[model samples]
Target chain A: MKILCNKADLLKGVSTVSKAVPSKTTMPILECILIDATSAVIKLTANDMDLGIQTEIKGTIVEKGMIAIDAKIFSEIVRKLPDSEISIETNDNLQTTITCEKAKFDLAGKSADEFSFLPKIEKDVSINISEFTLKEVIRQTLFSIADNETNKLMTGELFEFSGSTLRVVSLDGHRISIRKIELKEDVESKKLVVPGKTLSDITKIVSGEIDKDVVLSYTNNHIVFEFDNTTVVSRLIEGDYFKIDQMLSNDYETKVKINKREFLNSIDRATLFVKEGDKKPIILDIGEEAIELKIKSQIGSMDESINIEKEGKDLMIGFNPKFLIDALRVIDEDEVTLYLMNAKAPCFIKDEKENYIYLILPVNFNVGA
Target chain B: MKILCNKADLLKGVSTVSKAVPSKTTMPILECILIDATSAVIKLTANDMDLGIQTEIKGTIVEKGMIAIDAKIFSEIVRKLPDSEISIETNDNLQTTITCEKAKFDLAGKSADEFSFLPKIEKDVSINISEFTLKEVIRQTLFSIADNETNKLMTGELFEFSGSTLRVVSLDGHRISIRKIELKEDVESKKLVVPGKTLSDITKIVSGEIDKDVVLSYTNNHIVFEFDNTTVVSRLIEGDYFKIDQMLSNDYETKVKINKREFLNSIDRATLFVKEGDKKPIILDIGEEAIELKIKSQIGSMDESINIEKEGKDLMIGFNPKFLIDALRVIDEDEVTLYLMNAKAPCFIKDEKENYIYLILPVNFNVGA
Candidate 1:
């Protein structure tokens, strides 16, 4: 295989595919990036069993062949090479030579036949969404996904499509975050669970352009995202997601509307007094005109209040400050409303239209302790 | 103790002194910052046995007293507080109350008497240098200091004052770095070995302003640096420094003048083939008009060349790419002259006036291996 490509173009393609390259693997071949010039465009692919990324770059194909090169070394060399034309050639013995200006590198490449290729997905059912909207939805819900594999479904987010609305939901037993977006076209009802790691990697690859659209195609076992000359394929988590609808409630005994920035800042400050790995909860006392936030730990205690417009009866509730902070940070509105059914029920932070809902379970705490 | 200060001012002072607070120490008092309001200026001090820092912040003293607060918690609280005047009050029982805007914190403070204080240095011998110049000299020579305590003196830098010239030298056994600067006013000849950690911390505190001067005062055992309303006191390493004069040679059989940036870039690219903890050397083959750099490792091999203006007979030498890259990175010259005697002798990177000299010992290598 022989090809001549610009350093900038090659580096970008290498970096895009490198996201799926496993850092440590039992099979050494999984660490290699297959470079194929047989097609009109040079394609670079890296697969790590669960996730795979393939990107193409513009280059002149001197000879049509393929070779798998170590992703780490190839990327590093291309990154540091001069911003000029780079010539990559591979011999029959899989010895690849890279040359740019006055610098030259000779590396041992593995046979491309031994490399694992991404599973081809049949593009039967597909949906088109703007990159900006897709990235925003992922960012708003990805944080709530469970990091551990104890509950396989909790480690993945549920993507449900019905009518003209696409609803994304993620939870980790403690809290549930749901976001609903209007789709441009109507589609049949469908649901799939996507691993959090895959979505995290996809976010990095998308440019988040409002005009550019990403085509998402999914099969029974695999899902594919195609945009900007790059394609990402990830295996779907095979499990039924938790029925979060039962956990969400619309009835409330007390409701309050407060400035999002002020509430976020107060909760953030309260977090300073809570040490890591501690179960200290921030107690909120909703009164007539303001909500007093309190927390007491071994090191210190913090008490802060934010003015709020309240209705119904006043109530006191305790919650993990991190859950409240996470929901408030993603909200871009000037003010957010909070609804509480009672001290034992979960508190809901959502708009009247229910475009977004964040339900946080309350923790039992000694009042006025 | 009671004081009202702007949140920004308090945060700055806390951060400045927190550098001296050890992360883990047997003496808990060393992890606290003593807030002394007994004097006219509100001072915050932190000591870690070997190094101590004290800084004064502008604040109105409501009541004249002193208290000690945990550095980590105090800094975090002050950092998150609102940008307004913060009132800090301490009761007789060492319960400190800090209030800013609508937020308040009650922290347990330690006894001020238990906190360690910085050693007072008599300002009999002092030198005034612009913060920019001092910071530059330290940056240029600090990289050569040995990190390990195997050799007590090698872990420090020699600051020698002779007439109007102030020469600084530091070396690890393989290479030596020397930098000389002309002082504004003539002073008596003196010598002091300042610990690398002290100089490192001083660099972060200094603003590097050309108009601002940092007053450095030295005693028999301590060195004090006062600048920008901040004073840092550190214990100096006591021992005779190595005599690097013999290692620097003026004689040479082959000489080459090359662009500092180009040579540095070529050597840096060659470093890609070298693995961590590997002792692979970059071989330089000086020819009539260019120098070719070559390196071979188990992973791969790299060969690069840079055009140079050469003199005398051709010669080949090898050196650890890191040693050469370190010196080249710190030097500000566009073109540097290299003086080489033979493959066994050291290479000198300096000029005619010898304002800056870097002596690097070459490593033996097989010519065509």
Candidate 2:
């Protein structure tokens, strides 16, 4: 294949597909990126057995051909080349030469036919969402997913789409996070399970203001994201997701609006005395005007209080401080409201700026009646 | 011990000494920070046997006494308290009570007498040097020290202060870095081996303009640094330091000047190929007016040439690319100049910003050849 590409355009095109290239795989072709040059454009593709990525960029193509060169070496060389036009060509002997300025690299490449053919995204059921909203939703709900292999269903985030709203839910049995975003584009309803790494990579690439729109489409077993002239396709994790709606609270015994920063700091301090006993639980003693958090361990005990205008009858509840604090951090507002049912029920936390909610399971206090 | 201190002041004092506190030591006293309150100051001291740190903050003294509390617990509590005046008092039963606004922490304390005190520096012969200069010199030279404990002397940076110049030298046989600073302070000359961590911590805390000063004091077997209300004392590694002067170059057979950014980027790209070859060394073919960098492995081969104006004959040298890249990073100049004698001999790199030199010893590339 013969083609000419600008340094910036070439590097960006290669990097998009390089993430799917296997750094250590038994099959040599999995570590290479297949480059196909047509009359109008050039496509770069890389894939492991489970996931694949393909991106095409405009190039001055002199001849139409294909080859698979080592992704890591080619990417590194292209990334560090001086900002100028680069020329790449493949000889009939299966040797590829990449030349930029006065530097040149000749690498042995495999036949393009040896590469795994990636699945084509032929469906237009794609939906558009603001990049900022999608990234925030992932960050708010992703960390709570289980990281163990024993529970296959718990290792992925559950996504449900219905009535122009995309709902994302993640739970590890200890804590649950739910986020909702209104779809801006017309589309059919769908449901899918996204692996933990897919959510992490999505957040990594999507940040800042939502200047760019996000396009998402899914097949029977894979989901594809097309944004910023790059395409990333990942295999959907298949399992029976939990019905988290059953865990939501239906009654609220007490609710308080307090400064988010103050509550987080107080809970962090109270967590110090919890020494992971048979069951580590921090007790919150609520009064008319203030809430005191208390915990005792072998090393010491602590009592810290924050002021809030409590309205209901004074209540006491026991909770795992870490779970409570984790939920608190997802809120990016000056003031956050907490809805509690009782000492043994799940607690709900939410912020005004976001359409997200966090539910924390309480620990059994067993306080003498 | 009883004292009243600003929340910020107490937190800063505790963090400085707390860095040396042992996370898990067999001796319980070693895991605690000794807190002593006198007429108008509260001193915090912590040690992990190998290194000791002491810092004092001015506060209102309510009672005169001494006690040791768990370092991490106390620091965490103080860091979370409101930005108000914090008062700490000890009860008759030796329970230290910390109060800040509405928060309270009760922690068990051990007697300070059980802690082992480190040797103090003689107060007479302290030398004052520019804090910024000392910090810069340490940053340039300390990167060459070996991290593994296989070599006793190589694990520490040798500090030699004589006449008006303070010289820091470190080497791991494969590479050597030397930095010098001429100070106006007049004091007795001394040579001491300070642990690598001490230099790292000092650099972390000392940063300003080029004229601010820092003091250093030394005893028979320890070095003490006193600056910005923080005192770090470190045990010395006992041995006769190698003579670094004999390693400096008096004349060069050839000299080459190149743009610092260009050379750095080129070497960084070449490092990828070298790193792929079982961590093998890359060869530099230096000739009339250019240098060729070549790396070959079982997978493939890479060859790149960089143009350089030269005055000597052609030669070849083999060395690890990582060593050269590290030495190049510490340089803060637009242009870098290198002096070479032979391919087998050591090469010296000099930057135009300051009176510093780096010597990297080339590997014996052809031992089996």
| CA lDDT, every model vs. true structure | 0.93, 0.81
Q: How many clashes in each candidate? A: 0, 0
Clashes by residue pair, model 1: none
| lDDT by residue for model 1 (A134-231), tens | 99999999999999989999999999999989999999988999999999999878899999999999999899999999998899898899999999
Please report, as a residue range, the 10-residue window in candidate 1 chain A with the lowest summed lDDT: A239-248
TM-score of 1: 0.99
lDDT of 1 by residue, B1-369 (tens): 999999999999999998899999988898899999998989999999899999999999999999999999999999999899999999999999999999999999999889878887878878888999999999999999999999989999999998988999999999999999988898879888999998998898899999999988889898899999999999999978787786777889999999998899889988998898989999999999999999999889998889999999899999999999999999999999999989989999997899999999999999868
Candidate 2, after superposition: displacement of residue B83 in Å? 3.5
> Could you give candidate 2's per-residue lDDT for residues B1-369 as a string of tens digits?
688899998988888887788777898889898888853578888988778888888788888888888887889888888899999998877799999988888989888779877666677687887788888888888899999998889989998888887889899888889887787865577888888877887787665457767888888788888877778888889998888888776587877776677777777777766654466666777878777877665555567777887776667887788888898898888778888888788888976543778898887676233
Candidate 1 Cα errors over 4 Å, as ranges: none
- DockQ of candidates 1 onward, in order? 0.90, 0.60
Give the per-prediction TM-score of chain B. 0.98, 0.91
**TM-score (C-alpha) between model 2 and the true structure:** 0.90
Winning model by lDDT: 1
- On TM-score, the leading prediction is 1
